[model samples]
Target: MESRQRALVLHRLPYRETSLLLDLFTEQQGRIRLVALGARRRRSTLQGCLQVFTPLQIQWRGTGGTLQTLRQAEALSLSLPLTGRALYSALYINELLCRLLVPDVSYEALFGQYLQTLCQLAASDGQYEPILRCFEFALLQALGYGVDFQRCAATGTLVQDQVHYRYQAEYGFVTAAVASQDSFSGQQLRALAAGQLSDAATLRAAKIFSRLAFKPYLGARPLKSRELFY
Candidate 1:
């Protein structure tokens, strides 16, 4: 049977001689690996359309195996013109998705959110923190590891506006005996919960929280896209 869906090339690599292997995020199939036969050939039309961040309508066919063969791919639109920090941010999002998403499972809402994030990145003037934080939080929720900002997961106590807490990845936020430099205030957590990056402090807190939330799933390897920042 053949399957067709809307997709974005999350990553691609050279395959053998004139072929390419693609990691695609599809609306209907989530993350899938496809082998694009002869895509790297000089005369192949697919060489131009098989690009990262480009919207595509793809068709593939396979059985129960993990890999599929690409039957067709057509560009739905022009590739997004993301550059500078926005470009790096987009790469980070792609690499993060490739690392965390389970294969073959449908993430329809997340696919929409990913497209929206790309559009936001294309339109922004380099203030990417809030955009990234929101996407990261949404991805966590989609993965069933979302953090509860309104209450301590350990104690079930309401998060007070004045109290400070420290994040424990396995257990969520807990009351801290001392307000260390790394601690997050209840106000900041609440602001994040409300989708408000109202101040520099709150923005900083969101970045820290996202890092902590993703640490366990991401394991020990550093994300290649992150190095582009420095």
Candidate 2:
């Protein structure tokens, strides 16, 4: 049976001579690996459409295999021109999806969020933090490791803005008797939950939360794209 899906090109590598191996985040199929035969050739139309951060319509026919053969791919839009920090941020996004997402399982909501993140990165406005934090939050939720910034895991109550809360990597946020390295102000927590990145402190707290939230899945090595920012 033939499978047609809309996908975001995550990563692609040269396979043999003229062919390419692709990692795509698809709405219907999640993270899929497809072999694009002859895609690297000069005359192949897919060579232009197969680039990163471009919306693509892909058709493939396969099941019960580690890889699928791409039947066709059409570019729905032009490639996004993300430069400077935005480009690095976009690369980080791709790396995260490729590293964490389970193959062949559909995550439609995550896919939508990924597309939205790409759009924000393409803006070239240099406001990468807020968008990145939101996407990371959403990604964690979609992957079933959601952070409970708005609620206390122990008390099962709404987090208080005046209180201090400490984040436990295995657990969510809990009320803290004393502020420490892992603790953040409740106001900052609430602000982060609301996607409001107005203050310097809140941004700092969000950055800490991002590290804690992703620490479990990221393994020993640091994210390579993260280094590009500084």
| Predicted model with the maximum lDDT | 1
Regions more than 4 Å wrong, model 2: none
| 1-230: candidate 2 lDDT, tens digit per residue | 67897898889999999999999999988998989999999999888899889999999978735678999999888888788888889899999999999899889999999998889888747778888988988989988998777899899899888899988887988989998877998898889988898677888898899898898899998888788878
Please tell me which predicted candidate would have the highest TM-score against the true structure. 1
Tell me each candidate's TM-score: 0.98, 0.93
- Residue-level lDDT of model 1, residues 1-230, one tens digit each, is 78999999999999999999999999978899999999999999999999999999999998535578999999999999999999999999999999999998889999999999999999998789889989999999989889889898778988999999999996789998989877899999899889999689999999999998899999999999999999
At residue 158, what lDDT does model 2 achieve? 92
Flag regions of model 1 displaced more than 4 Å: none
Candidate 2, 60: how far from true, in Å? 1.1
Error of 1 at 100 (Å): 0.3
Residue 17 lDDT (model 1)? 99
